[model samples]
Target: MTETLLPTATGGEARSAAWTALRRVRGHVALTLLVLTVGTVIGLVGPWLLGRIVDLVIDGRTDELLPVVLGLIGVAIGQAIGQTVGTAMVAHVGQTVIAGVREKAIRQVLRVSEGRIERAGSGDVMSRVSGDVETVNEAVSGVLPTLLDAALTIVLTAVTLAILDWRFALAGLAAVPFQVVATRWYLRNAVPVIRAERVAEGSRAQQLLDSINGANTVRALRLESDHLAKVTAASDKARQLSIRMAAVQRRFFGKLNYGEFVGLALILVVGFYLVRGDLVTIGAASAAALYFHRLFDQFNVVLGTFDTAQSATAAFARLIGVAEMATPDLRDGGETDSRSGRGTDGSVSLRDVRFSYGADQHTVIDGVDLDVQDGEHVAVVGTSGAGKTTLVKLVAGLLPPEQGQIVLGGHDLAAGASGSGHRCVLVSQEVHVFADTVLGNLRLSGEHTSETQARSALDAVGASGWLSTLPDGLDTVLGRGGHSLTPTQSQQLALARLVLADPPIAILDEATADAGSAGAKTLEAAAEKAIAGRTAFIVAHRLTQAARADRVILLEDGRIVESGTHDELVDANGSRYAQLWAAWSTHR
Candidate 1:
C-alpha cells in the first residue's frame, strides 16, 4: 500500500499562500479598510461628544448643547452605514480568496498521476478535498473578518485614550506585560496542539469514509468488527486532541480575564488621582474611564479571536499546501497535440517492459515483449497476480514502465503527448457512473461531443434501446440518489463513452466480470461494438471471451507461457491453455 499524503505546509509556505490569496482580492481589501477606518473615526466621536456635553452642562452653557447632540446623532448614523459597507466588503474578499483556493486545489487534484491516486486510495484525497477545504472556508468566512475588526478597534481605541490623557492611557495599558506573556505562551502551545487536532480530524474522516465506501466488502469478508474498531480508534484520537485544544484555550482565557481586571482597576485608581490633582477636569476623567471600559471590551475581542485564528491559519496552510503541489508535465520530448495526431493505426508494441510496486518488491512485469496488429482482438488470460491489469495500465500510459518501451502505432506510448486524445482508453470492471444526466456522463468522454453524437455512440453500444425507456431519456439523472443502473447497464454506458472517445486502441480489464449470465451476453455484445475497429486488449476472465479473440496469450507469473489461436492452443495437448480450457469447459 502507498503512504498517505498529508495536507500541511511549513510557516514560510503558509505565509506565501496567504500573500497570494490577499493579492487576488486587493481591491476588496482596500475598500474594506477605508470604510473601517471611517467607521472607527466616527464612532470615537460619541464618547468625545459625551465628555463635551458634560463640560457644557457644568459651565451652564445651554446654547452649545443642541448642536452637539445633533452632531452626535449624525456621527452615529454615519458609523452604522460605514460598518455595514465595510462588513460586506470584507465578506466579499473572504469569499473570493476561498474560491481561488478551491479552484487551485481542484486543478492540482486533476493533474496528479492516476497511479499515485490509486496506490494512496480515495480516502486521503477525499479528506483533503472535502474536509480540509471546508475547514479553510469556515476560517475565511467566519474567523478572518472578526479578527480584522477586533485588531482595528484595539489600535484605534489605544490611540484615542492616549490623546485624551497620557496618564490615563498609561494606566489603561498597565496590564500589557501580562497580556503579552499569556498570549505568547498560548500561541507557542496552541499551534502544535491545533496542528495535531487537524491531522487527527483528517485521519478520522478518512477512516469513516473508508468504512462507508467499503461496507459491502467488510460485510462479505466478515470484517465489520475490525473496521468498527479502526473507526472508533480514529474518532477517539480526534476527540482527545480537541479536548486538549479546548483546555489550552481555557487556561489562556483565564489569564486574559485577570489582565482585564488589573487594567480596569489601575485606570480607575489613576483617574481619581488625576481629577483630585486638577491635572484634568472631572469630565476628562469620566471620559477616560469610559474609554478604558470600552477599550477593555475591544481588547477582549482581539485576544479571544486567537483560538479561532490559530485553527484558521492551520487550515489555510493545508489548502495552500494542496494548491502548491507540482503538476508534472507528462508529454514526452516536449511534444504538443498539434505536433502529433492520433496514432495512424492501433498496433501496440511492447519491448522488454519492466515494473514493480517498490524497489525491493519482486518485479510484477519483467522484460515482457509482445505485439498486437491494428484492429486485432487479443485476449490475455491469466490467474490473479499475473500482471495482466498492470500490463494494460502500461499500454494505456497510466503507469510508466521502469525499463524499455511500449508504442502504439508509430508513437511511443511512454513519450507521446499526454492528452486524452492521443492515448488508448481503458475500461475496467468497476465502471463509474457519475451523478449526472446520461447526456452529461456521455459528454465527459469528449467535452466537445454534441447531443446527436452522444446518442449515436449510445446507439452503437446497444444502450439506446433501454435509455429510451427512461423517463427523461438522455436527460435522466443517474448514480446515487438518481436512477440506479444494473451492472450490465453501467457497462453499456461505459462502452457508450468508449465509442464517443474513439481512441485508436482500447483495453478491457474483465469489464463484464460482475454481470450475470444474461447481463454478460448483453454487455459482451456492446463490448463487441465498442472494439469493432479498434486494436483491443481484453484481459479475459472467461474462456468464451478468449475463444472469440483473433489470438490468445496465456500468462503465468508475469511471463507469456503460451500463445496461439484458441483452437491451436486447445489442440496443443499439454499446453497450459489446454489445461485451463479443459477446466473451464468442465465448470461450464
Candidate 2:
C-alpha cells in the first residue's frame, strides 16, 4: 500500500467552496458592501473639500472655508461609523462561515476510516484542524476587513480624481504598470516559497507529534536526545523556509514601494502641468494630487496583503478538502445465516484473509480461514508479532483484508456496514475518556441515548460500584481535567460504551491488557458482560482472556496454527498452546 497525505482542494473546487459559503451569507455580504461603499463615498468628499477650500482661499472667499472644515469633520465621523459597522458585520460573517467549515471538517475526519488515518499521519490532519484553520481565521477576521476597505477606497478615489479632471485619473494610472509588474514577479516567486513553507511546517508538526506522543517511550529507551534532535532539525528547517518566504515578501514590498513613489511623482507632475497649462485651477490640481496620494495608501493595503491572502487561500483549500472527504454511512446489519451450524445472526467468517502494511513489507496476515458462530466468544492467542490485532481489526471492519472475503453477520465486509441495527465495533486497551460528563461520554455511543440508557450501560459493564462514588454521579465530568479514572475504571467505562453501542459483532483487541494483573479478572468479567450475546473476537494478549473463551485459536506468522477449545489445546502435549500454558501455569 502506498501512503499519501490528505488532499487539498483544486482551484475549481476551492472557488466553488467559496461561492457556496458566500451565497449562504449573501444577505450579510450585501449589507456589508453597501455600508462600506457609503463609507468610501463619504471619505472621498474629504479631499475634494480640501481642494474646494484651497480654491476658495485663493479667490478670497473666506466665508466658504467654514463649511468645508465642517464638511471634513462630518465626513470623518460618518466614514468612521460606517467603516466600523461594516467591518464588524463582514468579520462576523467570515467567522460564521469559517466555524461551519471547521466543524464539518472535524466531523468528516472523525468519520474517516482508521486505516486511512493510519496511512496518513495524525499530525498532518491535526495541524490542518488547528494551524491551518487559525491561518484562515486570521486572514478572514484581521486582513479581510482592511483589504475590503482599501479596495473600496481605491475605487472611489480613482472616480473622485476623474471627476476633478480626466487628466488626473490618467496620471494616477502611471503606477499600474509598476504595480502590475511587481505583482506578477511576486506571484511568480513568492507563491512557490509560501507553498514550500506550508509543506515544511506540516513536516515539523508531524515530527513534533511524534516526539510528544512518544515521550514516555523515548525516555524509557533513553533516546530522548535523539528524538529531540530530530524535532529541532525539523523545526529549524521550517524556520529557514519561513525566513526565505519573508525575504521574498520583503522584496515584493520593495517593488511596490517603487510603484508608490513613481505613482505619486507622476500624479504631481501631471497636476503641475495641468495647472501651468491653464487646463485646471490650482485647487483642482491640488485635490487631484491628494486623491492620488490617498489612492496609493489604499493600494498599498490591498497589494501588501497578497501573501496573507494566498496563505489563507491555501489553508481554506485544505480545510474544504477535508470537509468534503467522502464517508460511508455505516450501520451494523446482519442477515440469517446457518453456515456455522447455527441459524443465527452475527456469525463471522473469514476466507484466505491476507494483509500487508506496504508493498515492500512482508505479508502481515497470510491466508487465514476462520468461522465464528453467532454469540460465540472466540479468543485468538499469539506471541508479540503474530498479527492477532490485525485479524481482529479485519473482522471489525476497521481494516480491509488484502485478498480475501470477510463476512460479518452474513453481510460481505466490502458491502457498507449498513443495516437496521447497530454496527460492528472495535475496542482496544487504549481507551478514550472524552472531556465530558459521564452521561455525555456514554451518549457518544449514539447521540440519542437517554440518561437512563447510560445508567443501564454502566450497570451492565460492572461500573455501577464506582458510579455512586462520583461527586455528581452521572453528571460528573470525566477525562483530562475532571475525574481521573484508574486503568481498570477506564476500561470499565469503555465497556459501558460498548454496551451502549450494542453492536451485533464486537472485536476486543487486548481490551483488558491495560488493567494490569490486579484488575485483570475484574476487567475480563466486565468485557464478558459487554460482549454477551454478540459474536466477539478477542485478541488475547494475556492467556487469562483465552481461558474464558468458548474456543481458542493459536496464530503464528499470520496463520492459524491450532483451533480448538482452550482446554483441548492445553491437553495436547508439546503443542504451542500447551507449551505456552505450561509456562503460564509454572509462573502462576
Candidate 3:
C-alpha cells in the first residue's frame, strides 16, 4: 500500500492555501498593513530630517539645529511605537491563523478513515501535525513579518532617493540585476534541496520513533545492531541534506555580498560626480548615500529571510493539504430519523462484503455475508492474515468496505448513523489512557456523564476494588505522572468506560490479550459485565473466549470455514472449529 499522511500541494495549490490562510485573518492583516505603513513613513522622516539638519549646520544656522534634532527624536519615537504595535498585531494574526489551521487539521485527521491512517503510519501523520505545523508557525510569526518590513523599507527608501535626485536613485538600484539573478538562482535550486531536507528529516524521525517503540522487541531479537544501523543511515542522510542547505545559503550570501558591493560602489561613484558638477548639494549626496546603504541592508534582510519564507510556504501547503482531507459530510444525501436515543436492538448484518488495503493488492476481505442477532455474543476466530480485525472494523464503522453494506439496528452503518451515536464501540488491545484524573478518563467515554454514573460504571467493570486504593478515588489522576495502571487495570478501565458509553454493540479485538493470566480472568469477568444486554463481537485469540460465546466463527483466508456453538462445533468430527478446539485444548 502507498503510505502518505497527506497530499503535498503543488505550486498553484500552495498559493491557494496561502491565500486561504491570509483571508482567514484579513482584518488583522489590514490593520497590520496600516500600522506598518505609518511606521515606514515615520522612519523616512528621520533620514530627511538628518539631511536638512546637515544642510542647516553647513549653512551655519545654529538656531535650527535644536528644532531639527527634536523633530528627529520625535520621528524616531513614533517609528518605534508604530513598529512595536505593528509587529504585535502581525504576531496575533499569525497565531490566530496557526490555531485555526491546527484545529481544522485535527478535525480532518479525526474524520479521515482509520484504514487510511493505519496504512499511512503514525510517524508520517505525526510529523505533519507537529513538525510541519511548527514550521508554518515560524514562517507566519517571524519570517513573513520581517520580509514585509524589509520590503516596505526598501520601497520607501528607493522612492525617497528618486525624489531627491533621479540619477542617485538610478545608481542606488545598480545592484538590482545581480541581486535578482542570485535570488532567483537560489530560490530555484533551494526549493528542491530544502524539500529533500524536510523529507529526510521526517524519515529520520520515523526511524528513531520506530526504534524507540520497538526497543523491547529489538532487544529480545538481538537486532539492536540492525536497528541502530538503520537509524544511523537516516541520521546521516539528514545531516548531509542539512550541509547541502548550508552550502546553498553560503553561495547565495556570497553572491548577495558581491551585489551589495557593486551597488554601494556605484552610489558613491555617481554621487561624487553629481556633487562635483554642482547638480546636487553635499547634504543631498550624503542623504542619497545613506538611502543606498539602508536600501541594501533591507535587501539583505529580504535575502536572508527568503529561505525561511520558502520553507514556511512548503509547510503551509502540507498543513492545508491535511486540513483539506476531511471527508465530505456523510449525511449530505441521507435522511435523518427523528430518533434521539440509541435503538434498543443492536442486530448487525453484512451483505456481499469485500475490501482490500490497496487497488493493486489482493483482496483481504472477499464477498461474505453474516448476521448477528441482538444481544448475542459472537466470537470470531482466525489464523494470522484471516481478515478478522478488518471484518470487525468494517462492522463497527471504523472502515468502509470497498463493496458491501453494513446495517446496524436497521440503520445503514455507512450513512452517518454510527459515530458517537452509541451504535457501536470497538475496544482494541492497544487502548490509550489520557493523562487525566480517573474521573476524567471515565467522563471521556460520555461527555455528559456524572460522577455518580462514572462510579457506577467502574463498579460494573469490577474496577471499584482498585479505585478505592487510589489516593483520590474517582478524582485520582490516572495516566502518566498521576496514578499508573497495570495492563490489566488499564483494560478494566477501558471496559468501565465502555459500560458508561453503553453502545448497543461492543466489538472487542483481543482486548484482554495483553493482560497476564490472573489479569485476563479479571478482564474477562469485567468484559462480560460490560457487554451485558449488548451485541458483542470478540476477535478471540484464546479459544476460552470463543467457548463461552453464543456462537463461534472459524475463518480461513478471509472466508468463513465453519460456525457453530461451542458444544456443536466440538461434536462435529472434522470441522475447522473442532480442529481449533483440539489444538486449543492441547495448548491449555
RMSD of each: 3.9, 3.7, 3.6
Runs of candidate 3 exceeding 4 Å displacement: 1-5, 219-222, 269-280, 326-347, 352-364, 383-385, 397-423, 446-453, 500-502, 516-518, 541-548, 578-588
| Per-residue lDDT over 431-538 for candidate 3, one digit per residue giving the tens place of the 0 to 100 score | 889999988898877678888898888899899899889998888887888889999889988998888777788999999999888888988889889898889999
TM-score of 3: 0.86
What is the C-alpha local distance difference test score of each model? 0.81, 0.84, 0.83
- Best candidate, TM-score-wise? 2
Candidate 1, TM-score vs. the true structure? Answer: 0.85
TM-score for each model: 0.85, 0.91, 0.86
Positional deviation of residue 312's Cα in model 3 after best superposition, in angstroms: 1.6
Residue-wise C-alpha lDDT for candidate 2, range 282-366, written one tens digit per residue: 9888888788889998888887898899999888888998988876556544444432122247778899999988678898899
Better of 1 and 3 by lDDT: 3
Superposition error at 420 for model 3 (Å): 10
Candidate 2 lDDT (Cα, 0 to 1): 0.84
What lDDT tens digits, residue by residue, belong to model 1 across residues 460-507? 988888888999998999998899998999999999888887777899
TM-score-sorted candidate list, best first: 2, 3, 1
